[model samples]
Target: MVSKAMHRIDQQVPVLPIGDGVARSARQQQRSPYLYTDDEIQRILHAALLYPSPKASWRPVTLFTMLVLAYCAGLRGGEVARLMLGDVDLREQTLEIRETKFFKNRRLPLAPGVMTSLKHYLVVREQAGAPTNPESPLFWSPQRNCGYTVGGIRLILTDVLRRADIKPARGAVGPRVHDLRHTMVGHRMRDWYKAGINPQSKLPYLATYLGHKDIRSTLVYLNITPGLLQDACERFRKNGAAAPQTRESLP
Candidate 1:
């Protein structure tokens, strides 16, 4: 197998970094990521929490927990699906995301409300008699008897979005479930900018939290709009021409 051959070669000689090996095609412009508004996010969560039940299924709690984590932590759907019981520390209010995209591990802290929901889910899960072993999946499926799959989670999210009446922009490609991660970053930047904080100074922290390889990757998630531009112009005027250029105005 190629993997075995690569392993054997690696043992004999250090493997050379081949890079991604894909050629970048020149495009007219970068595709913008879709961002969710606060009301839409609330509706989405409400729909997820109200996922229809046979009156006893744990699907509602599982879906709710998954959505909250994805939005708050900027986690990829697969990362949420792959979480294990040992990865979550309710006491510490942190999640250990292990061996994720780019072969990196990171720690994600939960918001207080999110942690409360997780604790409530855990209580429900325990009462339902789901396995609580460290290696067991943190988000388990009662019917499938396994951890939630990426496809499964996607389907649920799609359904939740539909129920919430959140639609993609006319002729736009996205508003994909993964856009929740984009929304988190974009919203954070907007908040910082509105607060007169320099978002550029905090880019690295956001990059680390989102498990991006570098700030360049983080920058791809930011989309400048007329509103952001207007805010920057207003801030400049307020500062009497001494205002620093904001990250939003950077090329």
Candidate 2:
């Protein structure tokens, strides 16, 4: 439009800087996800449990449970923050995630170990005089007297990450809270490879487990890490050296 206006007036058209094109291209590329190792996760959990908060007596246990649920359940930060006490069914060992990213609800079964952790947290929370009403927030903050907002969860996790040495204390460039979801997917795929299970066949189930609308969205979270690569290579070699079966022996 500027160039056309200049042409009408018979004036010179100023050239735009080439840097705009370069910046636009950079914006279009997806940032690489940071995958946390099992050891790093343990360290973060330990740090969260030791986090200091003078106002909130239940802070330590709440933060610890929040991180565990986010990773173990492959839940988004908002999903974790929005969880209500009613959504967690200890008897059934399941969590009902309501109104997720795709505006769909999903119920996830908890592993035995995860259920044990939740029970312990609930016990401690009750001792701390936190609310036990079904409509109460699963993880509550004394300061807010309500469920944590998405931003609040991010701020807490950022501090824990810094304390765990998983991220620099003062930098914006580091692993994000959302990376926990990505790490969960990558770890699951690697475990499947190690167990000689066909990960390709499990993709759909994994997608649904993560509350993804399709496998393509889930694929974005599957980072190719060194451990995953090694396991995949080992699986390939084992299959290659296996004895060939006759057509009559095929299942």
Candidate 3:
């Protein structure tokens, strides 16, 4: 009998990519690393404005107003829900943001459109038989016979997001109600840069606008690099050249 030659069978092994970067990138996509982009934000706002609430006998008008106020005021959902008729100063074009987080309250200016939209809302609110007291909440559901709570506001946003197909991932994860507040601050910083405002110098103002007790909280929202980085680079280039040796010289 001839001895059979021993042969090795090749084992099936999966081919793996050489670099781990691809896997890392795939993991990162699973994470939300950035706020909504401008276009995405606009879509979000539009969807919010179009949200159909059972109590929206005015045809979702309150949803539109809420989105505008949330965007323009940088106000959190709690603050938005808590807003009262007298809190707004129509003549001064300012809103008195009261009893915010950290025991802080502040006054914030309003854009013309925000003021106008609110006035229009007030008209409809009166037509809908809203309470006559300025001390009462500005937002109340005729159907619910109560003011809109933070949960109510969140529900409206959640509904809108679902309708727009922009809802966050399930399992109690993803974007939050406060994200809109952060988004507004980010948008404000973007506009400030576009208008050539000194971001550092005006940080306090932003904090005040958002009713932040400290400037640091406000800075968290304006976390993007475009304005701050660009300003720093431009300032560096200018000072790199000879103008005044002493500090405190800028036009």
Local distance difference test, each candidate: 0.81, 0.86, 0.71
Question: Mind sharing the TM-score for model 2?
Answer: 0.86
**Whole-model lDDT, candidate 3?**
0.71
Q: Rank by TM-score, descending?
A: 2, 1, 3
lDDT of 3 by residue, 1-251 (tens): 01222222323433444357766667645654245567766777677666655656663667778877877777789888888888888899888877787677778889998999888888888888788697988886777767899998987776666666666645335555556777776766666665667667888877777777789777667666565567667765766665664444755
User: Tens-digit lDDT track for model 2 on 31-142?
Assistant: 5788999999999999998999787767888888889888999889999988888898988999999989999999999999889889988888777776889888888765
Between the candidate structures 1 and 2, which one is better when assessed by TM-score?
2
Candidate 1, backbone clash total:
0
Residue 203 lDDT in candidate 3? 85
lDDT of 1 by residue, 130-186 (tens): 799999988887676788788988877877787787854342244678889988987
TM-score of each: 0.79, 0.86, 0.73
* Runs in model 2 lying further than 4 Å from the true structure: 1-29, 243-251
Q: Which parts of model 3 have CA positions greater than 4 angstroms off?
A: 1-34, 53-55, 169-171, 225-251
Collision count for each candidate, in order: 0, 0, 0
In order of lDDT, best first, we have: 2, 1, 3
